[model samples]
Target: MTAPPDRRIAAHRPDLADRRLEGLVAAGQFVEGERWRIALASVPLRAAPRPDLPFETEALRGEVVRVFEETIEGWAWGQIETDGYVGYFSADALGPLAPEPTHRVIVPRTFLYPAPDLRRPPREALSLGATLALGEAVETRGTLYRMTADGAAAVVDRHVAPLDAPHADDWVAVAEGFLGAPYLWGGRTSLGLDCSALVQLSLAACGIAAPRDSDLQESAVGRPAEGPPRRGDLVFWPGHVGLVAADETLLHASGFQMQVVREPLAGAIARIGAPRSIRRL
Candidate 1:
C-alpha cells in the first residue's frame, strides 16, 4: 500500500530529499539565492500548498524565510528563520528581503495609518511582536508619527517598543492581557491565539526563547520547580500547558473556555486532568 500523505511535511521537509534534486545538488547543479521577507500581516505555513489543509505555523510580517522551491500554483516551500519551521507559504505573502526590524509592536494590535491624520483610514493593523523597519519620526498636532516599512506610518504612542527593550520582569502580567482573546489552533498573534501559542508569545515578549508547541516547550525551556507551584512556574499535561499565576492559580489560553482565563489550579487539574510535570523558569 502507498504511504499515507505525509503529515510531517510541515515538521520535516522531506521534499528537500527528492531524488532528482538531491542528485542535481550533489553534482553541484543547483542555484543559491537570498531569503525573502514576509510582507503581509501573517501567513500560514501549511503541510501542503493548499488552503483546505491544516497549517502548522504562521510567518509574521517582516520575518525572513529561505525559499527552497516555488510552485506554479503560487506557493513557496521554505524555512522560517524565527523558528526554523518548514512548510509551504503563499508566494503572494512575501516580498523582497528588507532591512532588519528596528521596533516591535507592544500592543495586541495597532493600526498603520497612511498619514498622521486620525480621520484618515488605516493602511493595516499590525499584531503584537510584529517587527518593522524604522523611518523618520514626526509629530503633527500633538500626535507623534513613526514611519514604518514600505513608507507606512503608525502613531508613535506607547503601543510600539524599541526592538532592544529590556525583557519584562513580570511575565504573568503579559499573559494576563489576553484574557478575552479568541482561541485559534495555530495562531500566535493577539488576533486569535491557542494555548501553546499564548505561552510561547508571552514568554517571547519577556525575552525568553520558546518553541512553537507545548511538548517541545516542556522539553526545551526552564527547570523544574520544587514543592508547591509558585508564580511564574509552568504546568504541563499531554499536549497542553498553563502558566502559574499563584500557588493555586493558573493562567492559560483555554480551548474549552474559547479564550484566555485565570482559574484555580486544582479545578483545572480536575477538568484537564493531572499535569505530567511542573517547572519554573
Candidate 2:
C-alpha cells in the first residue's frame, strides 16, 4: 500500500483534493485551484476555518495561494505557493493576481503610507520578506517613496530592494535583528514569529529557501555537522530549532521566554536538553 500524505503540505481532505493529486490520492472531488494573491501585509493560515483557531503559519503580502475552496463565512482553503503549506486563510486577505511583485521588503519592518509624506496616517505595517509591486518613484520633502502598483499606498524607497537583488551575506546577523520580538505560535513576520519562522525568514533574506516547520527544516536546510556548533550553524531538538550565534551562545525565538533572545548555549541545553543534531549552512 502507498504511504499516507503529509497533511501539513498536502492539499487534500476526505472531501476534496487538488486535481494535480488525482491519481496519487483519494478524495470525493478533485479541483484545479484558482490562484489568488495576498493583498494584506500579513494574514493567518489556520488549521481550521474559525477565528478561535490558532494559525499554522502566515502568508505574506504578494504571495500567491492556490485556493481549492471558499465558504460564505469568508474562509478559503488554500496552499501557500512559497512554502507549499496548506490551510485555511481569510478570503478578504486575497485579491486578483496581477502587476506581479517587483520589490521585496528587506528590513525588519516598515509602514505603508497612504501618501508619500511621513506626516500622513499610515495605511499598514509590513514585515520583512514581504513582496510588493511598485510603480514610479515619488518624492515628498526629502524622502523618496515607491507607490504601489494600484496607487493605494506608498512605501519608503530604502525599505525595499529589487526582487532580484543579491542576498545578505550573513543570515545569522539578520536573525539577530529580531532580538526581543514576541514568540508567536505560527507567525512568520517580524512583529511576531516562531522558532522555525525565525530560521526561515533569516535564510530567506539571504536568498535561501527553507521549509516552514522545524522537522522539514532539520531535514532539508543543511548538511550534518559532527563538531562543536559554530556561528550560523542550526541546532535542532525534538520539536524546536535555534541558531548558534557563537561558540557558546544560542539565538532563537524561545517560547519559554515568550520572545526572541540570545542566551548561553550551555544554559539553553540545560533548560531544553541537548540538541539532537547540528547542521551547518
Candidate 3:
C-alpha cells in the first residue's frame, strides 16, 4: 500500500513546535457588542483540514484557531491576533480554547447523511464535527448535511445558535440561502462553500450576481471608491480578500495568515494589500 502524502500544517510552518513570544497582539471586535480576548497559547485545530480551499503556510511559532466546519484534523490555518496566515494544525492536539460567543469555533467532529426527512428517526449513525456555523440551521427537509464520527449534518431540523455577530450570521444566511451549500470547487450548495465562493454566494443571496475569484470579485461587486469603508463592503488584498470591519477595519479569513481576522482599512491599504473595494449587495 502506498503511504498517504504528508499534508499537514507543519508543511506550512516547519517551526511550529517552537514556543516563542512573537509580539504584542490583540483580537478585534467584529460585532458591536463583542468582547475581546488576549491569546496566551496557540489555539490551533486539533487536525488540519481545508476551510474553503487548500492552504499554504510559512515559518512561524504561535497559535491558530482550527475551523472545523472548514478543515480537517492535522490541518489548521495559522493565525495571530493580527495576521491570519494560511497553514495547518494537528486537530484536537493543541491547547484548550475558551469557546465563547464572541469567538465562534467549529466542532472538530461531526457527521452527515442523506435522510428523506429530519422528523424521521435519525439513522443509527453518528457524525463527527466537520461543518460549523454559529450553529447549524435547519434545512427545508430530506437533506444530508454530511457526517464525520460524532454528529450528523442535515439541513432538516437543526437550529442556529443566537449569533452575536448578526452581520456575520446575515452574511452566512444570505450566502447559504443562495448557494444552498455543500458546493464543490464550483459546486453551489447551502452545505458547502469556499472563500470567494462565499462572497459571491452572499451577494447572490442579496440578489447580486458576481464572478468567481478575487480579480472577478473586484470588478463584479461595488465600484472603486476613495475613503474609509463602511459595512456591507468587501475588502480585497492581493490574491486575498475579506469583508469590511465596521467602517474602520476589514474582516476576513485571509489565506495570508489563515483564520478569520480583522484589520484597519488604512493599515491594510498601506501594506501590500490589493485595491480595497466595496459591494453594496
Candidate 4:
C-alpha cells in the first residue's frame, strides 16, 4: 500500500548546515569564531560614524547602524556615533548588542580594548551589586585596577561586567576551543599562538584586555598576593611561562617541550628552580 510513503529517505536539513554569516569572514572564521555572545549592558556609541576608528582596539565602538554589500567580500556595514567618521568592519564580528539610542555615563564603567579577551570577575566577588559603598578603581589598557583595603595597588583581569557580565559557565566553554592552537612568539590569532596570546585573546574576545606577554600577564591578579600556585592565572619560570589551572596545573607553549603542553604547576616551578614571579593579570 501507499502507507505513509517510504520512511527510509532523509529529508534535507538546511537551517543548521546552510547558515551563512552576514559579513566577510576571515580565513579562520569558519572554525575559530566565537558565536552567540552579546556585549554587556553598557558602552558608548553614536547614531552616525565619528571621524574615528569604528571598533575600539583603535576606534570608537559602533552600533549596527547600517548594513550593505561591497561586492568583493560579503556584507559591509558602517557604525556612526553622534559624530561622523565612517569606517568599515565585517558583519560576523557583530554581536547582539542593542542598536538603538546610545547611552553615555558621566562616570563611565567599562571600556573595551583592541584585545577582546578581558573580562570582569564574577559577581560573587562584589559585595552587593547595588547599594554598596563604591570606590574609584582604575583601568590600564582596558583591565581594572584597585587599591587594597590596607592601601596597596593591585590590577585584576576582570571576570565581570563591562568586560562582560558572563554567566558562570561561559568561561569554561570558551577555554575548551583553545586547546590545539600552535605556539607563536608574539602571535595572538588562530595560526601560531603563544601562552599569553592565548590568555589575552581568549579574554579579549570576552571584552577583556589582557597584556600581551607572559611576564606582564603573570604580575598581578589571582587569589594569593604571592603564590604557591593558583589556576586560570599565568605561571612563570626563568625565561619560560605557562598558564595555571585548578589542579595545580599549568599550560604553556614550552620551548623544552616545543609546543603547548600541560604539566603540574609545582613540577614546572621546581624544574625552573625558583620562578622569578607569578602574575595574576
Candidate 5:
C-alpha cells in the first residue's frame, strides 16, 4: 500500500481533496481549485477555519494559492503554490490573480507607499521575498520608486531586485540580518518568524527553495555534512533547526529567548540536545 500523504503539504481532508489526488486519496469530493493571489502584505494560514487556531504559516503578498473551498465564515481552504503548504487562509486576504511578478523584495522589510513621494504616509510594509509586479518607474525628491502594475502602490526601487537578478553570495549574512526579530510560532516575515522560517526566508532571498517546516527542511535542504559546522551549515534537532553563524555560534530564532539570537553551539546543544544532523548548502 502507498504511504499516507503528509497533511501539511497535501491538499486533502476527509471531506475534500485536490482533483490531482483523486485516485491516491479518499475524499468526499475532489475539486480542481481556482488560483488566487495574496493581496495583503501578510496573512496567517491557519490549520483550522477558526480564528482561534494558531497559524500553520503565513502567506505573503503576490503568492498564489490554489483555493479548493470557501466558507461563509471568511475562511478559504487552500494550498500555497510556492511551499505547497495546506491551510485555511482568510478570504479577505486573497484577490483575483494578478500579472506575473517581475521583482522580489530583497530587504528585510519595506514600506509600500500610496505615491512615489516618500514623504506621504505609507500604506503597508512588505516583507522580504514578497513578489511584486511592477510597472514604470517614477522619481520624486531624488528617490526612485517603482509603481505596481495596477498603479495601486509604489515601492522604493532599491528595496526590490528583478526576478532574474543574481542571488546573494552570502545567504547566512542575510539570515544574520534578522538577529533580534521576534520569534513567532508560525510567522514567516521580518516582523516575526520561526526557526524554519528564518532558514526559508533567508534562502529564498538567495534564490533557493526550501520546505516549510524544520523536519521537511532537514530532509530536503542540502546534502549531509560530517565535520565541524561552518557558516551557512544547517544544524537540526528533533523539532528545531539553526544555521552555523561562525566556528561555534548558531544563529536561529530561539523560542527560549522569544527572538532570533546567536548562541554558542555548545550552549545550544546543551539546551536543545545534540543535533540530529548537519547539512551544507
Candidate 6:
C-alpha cells in the first residue's frame, strides 16, 4: 500500500509511530479522509495530540482542512487548505465541509448577533478574515443573517465584503487596521498577530498570496523596489519584517513593543539595525 503523504509539520513527530499508523492504514482503518471547516473563532494546530503541546500554527474560523486521521481522544490530524499547514486540532472544532464562502469580514472585529437587533447580546465575536455564507439581507434592520459550515445561524452588519473582493491595490492600507493588536508568534487573526502574519493578512485582503513566515514571505511576493523605501513596501531583517506605512514610517507586529504599532523607519533601523532588503509586493 502507498504511504501517507509527508506533511512538513508532521515530519519527525515521535508521537506519530509509523508501525501503528501503517497497520491502521493498511487495514483501511486509519483515517476518515473527509473535508471539514473550522467552527470556532480560532483553534490551535498542535505539534502533539494533547492540548498541553505547543502550537506553531492555527486554523481560523471558516477555513477548511482535510482530515487524514482521527484519534479516540477526539483529535483530528489534518492539512489546512489555505497554506497546506499540517497539524492536529480538537475534533470538536470542526464542522461539515462548507460550500464556498460568500463574504468576508473587512473590519478588525465584529459581533455575530442571535438576531437582527443590536439590542440583543452578540452570540460571539468574529475576528478579521472570518468568512460567512450569506443567508438573507434585512436592510431595514441594518443586519444580515448568515450561516456557518456547521449550520449555525447569526446576524451581522452588511459591512462584510464579497469573499472574492479585494480591499484595494495598496496592501499597506490593510495592514494599518491591525494597529495595537497583541503580538502572537503564529497568530494571523486580529485577536493576536505576528509580523509575518500581519503581512500575510494584509496582502491576502488585497487578493495577493503570501507565505507563512518572514523568510518564506521574503521569497514569495518580494521584488526589490528601485530607489529608497516607500509606502506599501516590505522591509525584512534577519528574522523579522514590517510594512512601510509611508516613506519613513513602518508598521509591524513587533516583539519589541509586544504589539502592532507604527514607528519611524529610521528609528526602527537604528534599533533593529539595517534591513536585509526592501521589496514591493
RMSD of each: 4.2, 1.0, 17.1, 19.5, 1.0, 4.6
Candidate 5 local lDDT, 1-281, one digit each (tens): 99769989999988999998888899999999999999899999999988888879999998999999999988999999999999998899888786889999998999999999898999999999899999999999899999999998899999998999998877789998899999999999989999999999999888899999999999898999868788899999988999998777999999999999999999999989989999999
Candidate with better TM-score, 3 vs 5: 5
Candidate 2 residue lDDT tens string, 1-281:
99757888889998999998888888999999999999999999999898999979999999999999999999999999998999998899998899899999999999999989899989899999999999989998989999998898999999999998887889889999999999999999988999999999999999999999999999999999868888999999998999999767999999999999999989999999988999998
Misplaced by over 4 Å in model 3 are 1-154, 158-194, 274-281
Where in model 5 is the C-alpha error above 4 Å? none
Error of 6 at 121 (Å): 1.7
Candidate 3: C-alpha lDDT: 0.38
Go through the candidates in order and give the clash count of each: 0, 0, 63, 37, 0, 0
The local distance difference test score of each candidate is: 0.78, 0.93, 0.38, 0.39, 0.93, 0.77
lDDT over C-alpha atoms for residue 154 of model 5: 98
Q: Which segments of model 1 are wrong by more than 4 Å?
A: 1-14, 17-34
Alpha carbon lDDT at 30, candidate 4 = 23
Ranking by lDDT: 2, 5, 1, 6, 4, 3
Angstrom error of the Cα, residue 158, model 5: value is: 0.6
- Per-residue lDDT for 1-281 in model 4, tens only? 33321111111111211013213221222221122211222122222234243222111232233322222553322322221222344444344433321221111123322222245333211110111112246666775654222222232434222312442333323443555656655433344456655565445444444544455555533433365566555556654656666687777666556556677777777777776666654
Off by over 4 Å in 2: none
Give the per-residue lDDT of model 6 (tens digit) for 1-281. Answer: 76554444232233442232554333323343578998777788876688777666778778998787789999988877787677888999898665667888877787776656677788777777777776655543544545443445565655577776657676788888889999987787888889998998888778787877787788778699899898889999998999988658999999999999999999999999999989986
Scored by lDDT, model 1 comes in at 0.78
Error of 4 at 239 (Å): 3.8
1 versus 5: better TM-score goes to: 5
* Model 4 ranges off by over 4 Å: 1-176, 219-227
Please identify which of the two predictions, 1 or 2, would achieve the higher TM-score against the true structure.
Answer: 2
Q: Assess the local accuracy of residue 281 in candidate 6 as a C-alpha lDDT between 0 and 100.
A: 65
Q: Kindly list the per-residue Cα lDDT of model 1 for residues 31-90, writing each as its tens digit.
A: 342489898888888877889987677888888887777889999877777766778889
